[model samples]
Target: MKNEVKHVLGLSGGKDSSALALYMSQEHPDLDIEYFFTDTGEELEEVYEYLSMLEGFLGKPIRNLDPDRDFRFWLTQYNNFLPSAQTRWCTKNLKLKPFEKWIKDEYTSQGYTVYSYVAIRSDEDFREGLSSKNKSLVTKLPFKEVGVDRQGVFEILENSGLGLPKYYDWRSRSGCTFCFFQRKIEWVGLMERHPDAFEKAKSLEKSALEHGSPFSWSEGETLDELSRPERVEQIKRDHEKRLAAVARKRVVNPLRPDEGMVDLDEIYGQQKICLACHK
Candidate 1:
């Protein structure tokens, strides 16, 4: 495990991965970890802003692994089909591929064993992330090893003073502006928050449908349908109902009353999240 290892961690600009980076920095300060974030070119402007703040705390520039081809190019390659939970070509071509290429081409080819630190929390079961075909590339789960669950992640971020990304107030997951994994409420949140991004998402979905693609960004309905005034209100009501239900079910600790915001995953149920983009 110690033959010229190159320690690296990928930041998803989400609470878990960002917290993990801070956790590793404070806990394993001696490891000399190199942090990186893969740019999908469709990421929210807020994500880039958050990354800038994170860079200050880490005291190192998180390398940007830009894909050789951007999202529009890949979408064209797939016949303009939108990447969905079922067919996540975006992660494959944008996130994982770039990481693999950067590590293998820049480091592994030179005989450096890459130790990729991932942010899989202890509360969750084992979920497969970016797996490497190369024997020398390895993944380390620091959060799971030290029993740091969701609350622990919250604490780590809060204590760091960097805190959660601004989007967490409305959306829990962070990825592309039009991430299909988002709940209906989050799509509504997008429409309200970043209207331009929401419109772009609608345009992409329109293009996909015109190209004979079967899926929309969200599930049954198109973004146009989802954004209608009444439909948006309904989605908001449903979200609030579920949020209250979740709040009632939770056993809140008196010690921390501030960490009681409703997680969207709890409302819609936990979908298979994007480890590379959402963490």
Candidate 2:
């Protein structure tokens, strides 16, 4: 018997994914895509707000896929070692597992084919995570298929009046509020903007250290050490130098230089960021 097929898109509450969602809604209005967000329980407040704005634009509720267990539970399961880029149990347990569980039960169990839309930009190399183990679940990249780069993403957001997320001014990428992938300067921004969240991250790192974990939230130093006045100043100074270098490289395109400007990845070297979390 032939099975029904479902089109779905997962929004990461980051600019690229949000832009992709808006792009899909406008370009493929005929396709009834079910948009979803895999919540980590430790996401930034701005992420929730932006999700709401996206919901309004889509005229549909973004289904939230929450793990059966939260971060603290998973932390304990990993012997109190905080999840780092090396061992990202947080993404597996919190983000990807919940999503896989939902889709496996809903679509695979019912013998339905699932088309999952991902936002891997044309400028970026396609990584390995988006692949689905279930043969019934197919992954799609509309942005890459249409050759939409970072600038095209920005234009899509601006044209839709959704602009970038408010945290873009400070944080370069979106994921957990205490995402270990954050650079030293972003840690300072966290200390300044969300002191409570910063403190929570510090306490978690302290616990991990006490448990003899090899990693801190950031490498080389503890959050307590990083938050010191002198260290903070140093990080800020280094970041300013990087920004100045980026500014110098910016060529004035008379047509849309002001509008296009620069993006975070340009100023800060693009790390091996998770597409599910940062896209």
Candidate 3:
């Protein structure tokens, strides 16, 4: 007998993917899609909270695909170097590998075709990472198909009462609390909001440096260096300047001054962030 095709959507604990899930639920109720989150075991507390809220709305448990091996295990296997954009072993081993394993064993082994729904918005160009390797594993972008841009995504979340993740008020994007992709200001935000996590990142960086690793958690500085009073003041001042510049560039709608709140990519410039982790 031919196998049934399975529909799946991944939730990254970010606004875009969550909005995409809600949009799919409302717009395509007939499709029984399996929602999943690949937990890194190092994600923020707020990420779990947001996932719980999403589950409440979905009326189903978002499947958790945890790696058999944790971040530290992978770190050791990768020669103790911290994961950076140049060497993102964390996302590969912690995030993407687990998801691929789960789907391969659970769905593909049953000869089922998986149609994975991704949340690439209409305003954003489709990225190379969203592509699937297996012929049977098809990829879909509901937001792009429906013409839902960032504003539309915000509207969906607002109407759904999920709103944005709490970290957005300070930091932006979602992944591990100590994600190396964070801007220096975001590292400072982590230091202020979740000091323990910030300290853990510092310890990791220190160990990596002790082993002669080239990259710091953030560019051009270590977390300990970035957290010093004087350096913190400088980072804050630079962030304020950038925010003011972005705010000035905004043509006020006379209706939405709040729209001036800058995104991480906008302030720090876009990095090669993984959609599976940061979307």
Candidate 4:
């Protein structure tokens, strides 16, 4: 018997991946794509809500590729060191490992060639993606191939009626609640929006630091320090200044001139985005 070919798209509950999925379904409806979300088990509640909303649009079950173990288990294994941007063990052990294991065991081992669809926009370089080392797994960038950039992604989501993730109103990026790539402003946003989740992140950071780990959740300061009323005020003010600076430099888009719009990437500059966590 000949091996089968499979198409899979990963959703991070972020704009890009969701837009890609909508684009693929509209443009390549003939392709039988399997959408999946690799659960970190630490994802924001809004992420799950958005994924559920996305499923309603796709008219397909978005498979949940959950890890066998949770973050606490992995944290213990790593001697309680929190995963930092420099060393994102969370992305590897928690996110990617579950995804890789799922496909390799459930599909590739059964002689299936997995074609993974990534959301690297036309403006984005192919430098960031889950480029598989497995001979059986291949990566595809539909957005880049079709010249779909950031603006195009926005349109796709808007027109699809799926819109952006709810958390985008608070935090632009999607991942675990305590993603180390978060900007100071976003940390303050988390503290304000989801106080409990914020507390959990602080607890994790405290444990990690107690174990003598050089890395805190965010660099330079502890979460406790960041959460201080004075420090939070400073961060908010600094963010407002950055946004004003961006606004001054902004060339107004005649098509959709929403001047108040402030992209996190525009303010802080895009980080080395995690493929598994950020899509």
Better of 2 and 3 by TM-score: 2
**Model 1: per-residue Cα lDDT over 28-116, one tens digit each:** 89999999999999888889999999999999999999999999999999999999888999999999999999998888888899899
Clash count for candidate 3 is 0
TM-score for each prediction? 0.96, 0.97, 0.95, 0.96
**Clash counts for all predictions:** 0, 0, 0, 0
What TM value does model 2 have?
0.97
lDDT of residue 142 for candidate 3: 82
lDDT string for model 3 (133-190, tens) is 7667888988888799877888899899989998888877889989988888888899
Per-residue lDDT over 1-279 for candidate 2, one digit per residue giving the tens place of the 0 to 100 score = 349999989998999999999999999999999999999889899999999999999899999998889999999999999898889999989888888899888887788899999999998886768777888999988888999988888899999999999899988888999999998888998899999999999999999999999999998999999999999999889888889899888787787665546666888877889978998
Model 1 residue 146 lDDT score: 94
Ten residues in a row with the worst lDDT in model 4? 125-134
- In order, the Cα lDDT scores of the candidates are 0.89, 0.89, 0.87, 0.88
Residue 8 deviation, candidate 4, in Å?
A: 0.5
- Model 3 residue 155 lDDT? 82
Residue 118 displacement in candidate 1 (angstroms):
0.2
Consecutive 10-residue window with the lowest summed lDDT within model 3: 253-262
- How well does candidate 1 match the true structure in TM-score terms? 0.96
Give the per-residue Cα lDDT of candidate 4 at 252: 88
Q: Distance (Å) between predicted and true CA of 55, model 1?
A: 0.8
- Which ranges of candidate 3 are over 4 A from the true structure? 253-260
